[model samples]
Target: MKYIKIRIPKATVYFTPVEIEKLLNKNIEITNKLLTQQTEIFKEGLKRGKCFIRSSKQKIREERKI
Candidate 1:
């Protein structure tokens, strides 16, 4: 048997803010800080993926030239 590992990049999702103050009082609502941190995480992961793709393309080009 062979195993393959793959990583899929996730795009940022748009979530509607509930206007009710009662919903805001619950722990289930995401805090602004947490949302900011999650956004940064997504940005970083996508950035890394983009760099990896560029590097791989460069390597392939170099190999073809040789």
Candidate 2:
């Protein structure tokens, strides 16, 4: 009598549930830090005589070709 051997392939995942959660938390922390730094810079710019001025709109007689 001859017996046949079969092999099954196993599926591999790169990120498990715990790992994904850690990654997401780290990304959120980094983003919050960056936002805080940017806000500080914007506040300083506002105090240093930086202003947003609207440019005068000009009437265009020529039509733009799309």
Candidate 3:
């Protein structure tokens, strides 16, 4: 199996495609659970947020010094 490398704040994680898919699924499940448990807060017109893709890419490049 081919492995891909993922770098986070202070660590690198290696994952095969299958393992990556499983990890994403697990994250979705956990996120769903948290959202359900906090329905009231979410329903109060709170918007979900994400890092800007370009900014995130730049940050990763800076961290990796590549």
lDDT of each: 0.72, 0.64, 0.82
1-66: candidate 3 lDDT, tens digit per residue: 799999999999999999989989999999999988799676554443233666777899999996
> lDDT value for candidate 3?
0.82
C-alpha lDDT (0 to 100) for residue 66 of candidate 3: 61
TM-score, cand. 1: 0.55
Which candidate wins on lDDT? 3
Runs off by more than 4 Å, candidate 2: 1-13, 50-66
Cα RMSD (Å) between model 3 and the true structure? Answer: 20.8
Work out how many backbone clashes candidate 3 has: 0
The lDDT of model 1 is: 0.72
Superposed on all Cα atoms, model 2 deviates from the true structure by an RMSD in Å of 14.5
Inter-residue clash pairs, candidate 2: none
Please state every model's RMSD to the true fold in angstroms. Answer: 19.4, 14.5, 20.8
Give the alpha carbon lDDT tens digit for every residue of 1-66 in model 2.
333333447744455566767878999999999999999998988766433322111122222321
Worst 10 residues of 2 by lDDT: 53-62
TM-score list, all predictions? 0.55, 0.55, 0.51
